[model samples]
Target: GNLPIKKVLIANNGMAATKSILSMRQWAYMELGDENAIKFVAMATAEDLKANAEFVRLADTFVEVPAGKNLNNYANVDVITRVAQEQGVDAVWPGWGHASENPKLPNTLKEMGIKFIGPPGPVMSVLGDKIAANILAQTAGVSSIPWSGSYGGPDDGPLQAELNDEGTIPDDIFEKATCRSVEEAVEAAKNIGYDNGIMIKASEGGGGKGIRFVDNEEDLKNAYIQVQNEVIGSPIFLMQLCKNARHIEVQIVGDEHGNAVALNGRDCSTQRRFQKIFEEGPPVIVPPETFQKMERAAQRLTQSIGYVGAGTVEYLFNADTGNYFFLELNPRLQVEHPVTEGVTGTNLPSTQLQVAMGIPLYNIPTIRKLYGKEDIYGTDPIDFLVDEYVPIDCHVIAARITAENPDEG
Candidate 1:
């Protein structure tokens, strides 16, 4: 496992998380330092024209990837990978949040004798898929919205029936179906009150754009339709409409040797328009017993699947019913990963670089003592949105800059 994969190209758009880019660049630049040997670049798609140019100017190297943003289909995979190979990029980093749609890109990179940074292709696929994410959590017996990674056809129709409009779902009901229609979605949303009123959502590339919490039919219709185009336009939609509850997430680092350990859990209950405005660590509602339970669950899944690099196991809570369910797995670096960094006082991305270099996570200890403590979830623990989208622009750390259009950059 000699993973000396330096020079990673972070393939994403300008509209991507500015904070995430900053954090990763901070580490990548430091890793390179004055060596100037290997370069970690942020490759911008056609859509991310302005930001990509600005980013390249701010950081070190940049690539104006002409790759299409409409899901890495036949042409995009080869296009971006070709850019990497042509540019002599050592590895490709798809940024934080989830895996790449071009599953072939990783293998293609490997075959071309280049390294694919972040999680391995298969591991990323499993964790990225909602249905597969649930299956990963099964060995841990972690509760989630009860989901399948993708939607099924006729066989799924009956399960879909259970969520009839205005109808109620019994607590004992297992086996849930993925819904797309506005009507079925509304019924599922209304059932949230009884089911603790929560839902889980995952999308292809738009990581923070898909989640929605609907207390009733109206909310469901509004949210479902709003996100439907993005959902249906793609090959698959990893969405779960369930109860609104506690936001529990555990971050981990694994290696090819199959060592996985929880970095601790963070509660991000406060969010707006799907963006986590505030986040804290140690999980308040999830004390020692639940924290350990969640941690062990995540570790087992990671080992069973031979997952490597950083990943997160998300969960939804029904505080009223006191029931928490496993949500979805984020297969890449997270936007809120910094809070976990702030809490642990550890450089997660640096540790990730080590893992990318074939380092095992055995040196990292489990958070058993952290569980025994009060499990402080972190600071700034609330979503700052009452109405109107604020974006991260308002934050001090965030700098606002105007950029020219696509070709202008």
Candidate 2:
């Protein structure tokens, strides 16, 4: 049931685009042979062309997007989709940033009969929203941090109804732990019993934005206000901050046929200002049993949501207590995915494209060995346990280098 996908549009720029294009070519050469190599279309702004960006140069062909601001080009769903349509692209690859997680992009591509190399629009919407994702994770039996909000209880009937109807949670559905006022936040903090501190988090927050740490009631109001101001109108929630916890994530891939597998994981605890600086696979700090539990939880969540494509299920592991809480599910290829690839020997970008082409995980040659089954088909029961089949052969770590202003430092 594979759909034809001869041409792909890399709807991003820079490293994300560069890596994806390279992987796609490598996958084509190895899997499809030289005569059937997939053609790639890379995008660039006027300024990028002037700089002679590496991705544009690597692509089989390049398209020009407007310069000035990203919204007019890279982040613009209209522009990206338009380019895809114009180029006769069979599939679109939104690497990590830009419009990767924006459900609008996928929804639009779905409508246009073009394949989106990630989760479906509805699945993306559910997982992209922190509040909805947390509730869904809880429903899927994934362990989550104690937090204030609708924990999929009887009181969340209205919210659940709305989600079922629209595939999204409305602003008015914020209940229990979600605080609109400072008073509600204080009560939530007290109820959660944060010995270390409580975090005021915006539901739409990511990459260290829209977050505030309050150690006591005295600072709670100000922190709450700051977070509210940062994300304006976004639902805010309170959660007990796990002190000295290691950041861990499970690399998961699901297919249209309901098959999902966990490809081990990485420890991304090395961070500065809430941004990961280093990442490594086969999280040795966490016990093997606990890590397996994470893998199972991750795979269960993926299958429950019917998510198709490459994704990362993140968690905060308290090594001392051997307890871990689900953080979030990033519904697209992650920037730090190379660490998992290094250990698992899987090319995530190529896998994503294959999944988009209606190929099941059991059929994907790069991942088929992990399942240890020769005749797994679309009609078979979905059970591919990573611990039973996949072995972590090596440990690999990645360090990120960033340029910063000396004055700011």
Candidate 3:
């Protein structure tokens, strides 16, 4: 990225974004050594902070992160700001969509004159809420699913999407996106207009945590009750179930100068119970034409909104007609960034920081012309090139790559 840096702070602790923090720290050190370049700090529970003694040691400082029992987030912006003020950090990178409306974080950090190393809070809020995301997708004309507000609660209001009541879900939906009122839910079921089956999602949540398929009215009714009970504390959600669908997503970036381009699209169909255990880029299906069309739609959304930074737009592929619908938008770096990195040869975090700091992308001529299918995926390609094997969503993977650190070496 060639981004000149002096200081950085990370606002979450998840193994998923472990590489982003460590790599940035190491890469910065290598580029600028320990003096004028930078240092890193991670905020999370004191217990979690203690667990990674070695990793914490690499950080210039460590701040005790406070969270509720669920660990739903590690966002105590007050504490983070104090540390940033004390340490004089130039930026705070919310790792992997970590601060999803922790409310106090963004405004506090902005007030302190420290940069939030992600997109604007408005963009994040627009994409974080599932229903809002669905609306954004429709407005952008992107392919994904339509989702109504949270469903399933005794005293709750009405629901607008479909519902099911046949009773047997392959798994269950109460776990993540909760539910709405039964009457509202029942009415929603009648409105669905599909014969095969319908989906019940937790409207107030995600992380692929709460979602289920109710094959019939009986299932939908039972699911409504179950989800309503489950989300008594947080709201449960519901949506238009896209069955036998191929889940796909594209990592998009826009700049202050009005440029929105896709890094690449990933096929997340190999998920079991909605948790994506495997993924690969340059979609297995969706010929070049379809891919480009999707990208154009996605870029239009980001461009229209003047979106900047690393964001992901998710879509659903309908097997019935091979059409994609807007599922939602992830207005932050995703877990699958490595797939895009392997293809684009670009540092997304650097791009995001630059853009957020009022830097334009036009100077980088390769912004949109990055990585064609010929450069990576294709038959009869480069004879001297090594073949690559990316995991398709299917099995248990507990693997690690071990290598000597170049700096140490």
- Candidate 3: residue 335 lDDT (0-100): 71
Candidate lDDT (C-alpha), each: 0.55, 0.84, 0.59
Q: List per-candidate RMSD values in Å.
A: 10.8, 3.0, 10.5
Which prediction has the highest TM-score against the true structure? 2
lDDT of 3 by residue, 212-300 (tens): 67767778888876665554444444566767778888878877667666766777777654567667776757766576677778888
Which numbered prediction scores highest in lDDT against the true structure?
Answer: 2
Candidate 3 Cα errors over 4 Å, as ranges: 1-5, 14-18, 25-36, 44-54, 64-73, 97-103, 144-180, 233-238, 364-409
Off by over 4 Å in 2: 150-163, 169-174, 372-382, 385-387, 406-409
1 or 2, which is superior by lDDT?
A: 2
Worst window of 10 by summed lDDT in candidate 1 = 384-393
lDDT of 1 at 56: 52
TM-score for all predictions?
Answer: 0.65, 0.92, 0.74
Candidate numbers sorted by TM-score from highest down? 2, 3, 1
